[model samples]
Target: MTPAARHAAAIGILDRWLAGEAAEKALTNWARTNRYAGSGDRAAIRDIVFQSIRCRRSFAHLSGAETGRGLILGALRAAQTDPATVFTGDRFAPAPLTDAEFATETALPPAPSGNVALDCPDWLRPLLDRALGDQALAVLEALRHRAPVFLRVNSLRATVDQAVAALQAEGIDTRPAPLSPRALEVTGNARRVQTSAAFAAGLVELQDAASQAVVDLLPLTAGARVLDLCAGGGGKSLAMAARMSLQIFAHDIDAGRLSDLPARAGRAGAPLHLLDDAEGPERMAPFDLVLADAPCSGSGSWRRAPEAKWRLTAERLTQLCAIQDSILTRAAALVAPGGVLAYATCSLLEDENSDRIAAFLDRHPDWRCDLSRQFTPLDGADGFFAAILRRVD
Candidate 1:
């Protein structure tokens, strides 16, 4: 498809997304219906859709409207591209800009600062400010762009150097991420990772560098019994297994999320025992370490899931906090005497990170937090928080 055709397609998908359909769903539906759109076309369209969403507020401001056309036009202007190039009303291109649109696009003033400029929702601004202070705007600004792809060298199968060599052989260039020794930030040809020989042989797995850093910080030991309390997809569980010889068990409240973990573990050659909703937590009590990668507003990962920031509500955040509290309480009970409970979230909000740790300590005097750390995009990774709490007699 022509570049103009791709933009037109992105406009339609963005319109469906604006109408309340999920961006991914709209893209999938569009792809399925337009079977003739090649892989390149689909990828190009998807990039346009996600980029538009990532900078939605600023785009809206630039175009003076929140519609799909406005966002695409704004995107083009942001790239310093001529709107007339794609909005040419040529075959398979978006309709020509109206005189009013032309005026808006040409005479567009600089976007207002703060929330809109950062693409941060108004209600979330105070929360971010309180949590990040001077870095709030920088963090939000980072979210307005795409996140880099990171891979964790599965040490159980390959050394970091070995993984790098194998990936390089496949035309995927990577450089070590300073956040974690095992992390490789994919520099080029990231789209071919899944098909690369290294990935098929379990030499590397798609994981964020911050996530690898979090796992690296956990209190792990060889032959220890570990429980991943909320091990959705078991990314951390596999990472743990690769880090040391651990008898790791995975469980999630929603069993469906664990359905693919077994195959993933098999591929990585990381042995992981699975627990179903009816079975784990109580029956498998007294684990040496329990990791609750709790669910949150996902604010730290807005770069990857931009719509989540726009969709988050105060009520929903409150509910999530309550659920996090409940998970802490229940997971604590499953900890062995003197074992550790690792609480983590992909959120930059204090209400979800340190505040939750404080509340847990206040309620449980017998336990003490050993370490707490927050990772932000400034650290070359997504925002992540992890705290280690140890039980004492």
Candidate 2:
């Protein structure tokens, strides 16, 4: 498809998304219906749609409207391209810009201010500022662009050099990410990774560099018993398994999330046990380390899941904080006397990160936090917070 047609397609998908359909679902539905759209066309259209979402408010301000057409027009303007080129009224192309749209070209308002310019929700601005301090604006700006694709080399299977060579042979170029020794930021052909021998052989797995860094901080010992308390997809469990010879058990409130973990563990040659409520993870309790990678607003990952930023509400955030607190309290019980209870989230908000940890410490005065670290986009990784608390009594 021509570039113009791709923009037109993106406009349609964005409209569906604005109308309450999920971005991924809308894109998938479009793809299924438009079977003629090639892989390249689909990818290009997806990029356009996501980028527009990331900078939605600023784009709306620029185009003088909040509709899908306005967004595309704003995108073209941002890229210094004329909208007339894409909206040519040609077959399969977007219709010519309306008179009002033409007027918008000259009557664009002064740049958006404060939260709108930052593309951050107004209610979230204060929380973000509290969490990020002086770095808030910079981090918010970073979320307006695409995130880099990172791969974690399975050290148990292959050396970093071996993984790089294998991926390079398959046309996927990568370089070491400074955030973690095991991380490799993909430079090209990232889409081919799933089909590459390196991935099939479990030489590497797609994971955020900062997430890998969080796992790196775990104090793992040979034969240590580790419990991933909220092991959604078991990413941390698998990472820990690959790093050391440990008896790893993963448990989640919802067992369905672990459905693919067994296969993933097998591929990576990691020894992981899946525990359900019926089996009781507490039955194998007193774990040396328990990791609670709880859910959150996902503000740190807005660049990848831009729609989530717009979808979040104040009530939802409060509910998540309550859930995080409950998970911390319950998971702490499974930790042995003197074991480490690690809390982690992919959120940049202080209420979700530091504040949650403070609340946990307040409730359990016996546990003392030994270490805490926050990773942000400014550090070239997703915003993440990890704190290691050791039981003293």
Candidate 3:
């Protein structure tokens, strides 16, 4: 498809998103109906849509409206591209810009502060402030951009050197990430990675460096019984399995979320036992290590899923924190005497990360924090935080 047609396609999809449709679902539905769009076309359109979402507030201010066409025009303008070239009104192209649309002032819009200004939900600004303080603005600024793809070399299957050689042989250039020993940040050929020999051979798995670091923070011991209490898709579970020869047990409140984990574990040569919700506390409690990679507002992943930034609300955030607190309470019960419980989240909000940990510590005097660390996207990876706590009794 021509570049003009791509912009037009992105405009249509963005319209769906603006009209309350999810970004991924809308894009997938569009792809299914428009089989004429190639993989490159789909990816390009998705990128444009996400870019618009990431800078929605700024773009809306510049373009003078919140519609899809206005967003596309604003995004193009932000990139210093000539909208006239792309919105040529030719067949399959976006309509020509009206006089009012073209009459936008050259000066940038006045700064918005807190949530409206940051393009984040109002309720989340306070949490971000509490989490990062003066760095909150910088972090929010960094989130209004693209995320780099990082791969973790599953050493259980292939050594880092072996995986690097394999990926490099497939025309993908990657550099070792300082955050995690197993992580490699894809510097090039990310488009071809899915079909790369290294990926197909299970020598590498696409995981953020920070996420790898979170799993790395877990103090794993050989032959220990570990449970990933909220192991969605079991990414960390499999990573932990690769780190140590532990009897790994994976469980989630929604069992369907883990349906792909068995196949994924098989591919990565990870041995993981799946526990259903029906399993009683008596049977599953007393684990040496319990990892609660709990759900949250997903503030850390805003760069990748920009649409979620606009969808978050204060009430929703409160609900998520309550759920996280509940999960931690339940997960603590499963920790054996002298066992460690590792809590992790991809949220940058203090309420979800440090604040939740504070609450947990307050409620459970028997457990004490061992270590806590957080990684921000500005550090060239997705934001993540992990806190390891040990039971005294």
Runs in model 3 lying further than 4 Å from the true structure: 105-117, 280-282
Q: Using TM-score as the measure, what is the rank order of every candidate, best first?
A: 1, 2, 3
Clashes of each: 0, 0, 1
Write the residue-wise lDDT of candidate 1 on 250-363 in tens digits.
998888999988888988999999988677678988899999999899988989999898889999999999999999999899999889999999999999999999999999
Better of 1 and 3 by TM-score: 1
TM-score-best of 2 and 3? 2
lDDT of each: 0.92, 0.93, 0.87
Give a tens-digit lDDT track for model 2, residues 262-314. 99898999989899998777898989999999989998899999999999999
Pull out the clashing pairs in model 2.
none
lDDT of 1 at 244: 89
- lDDT of candidate 3 over 198-239, digit per residue (tens): 887778888999999999888999999999998888889889
TM-score of each: 0.98, 0.98, 0.96
Cα RMSD (angstroms) for every candidate in the order listed: 1.0, 1.1, 1.8
Question: Ten consecutive residues with minimal summed lDDT in candidate 3?
Answer: 105-114
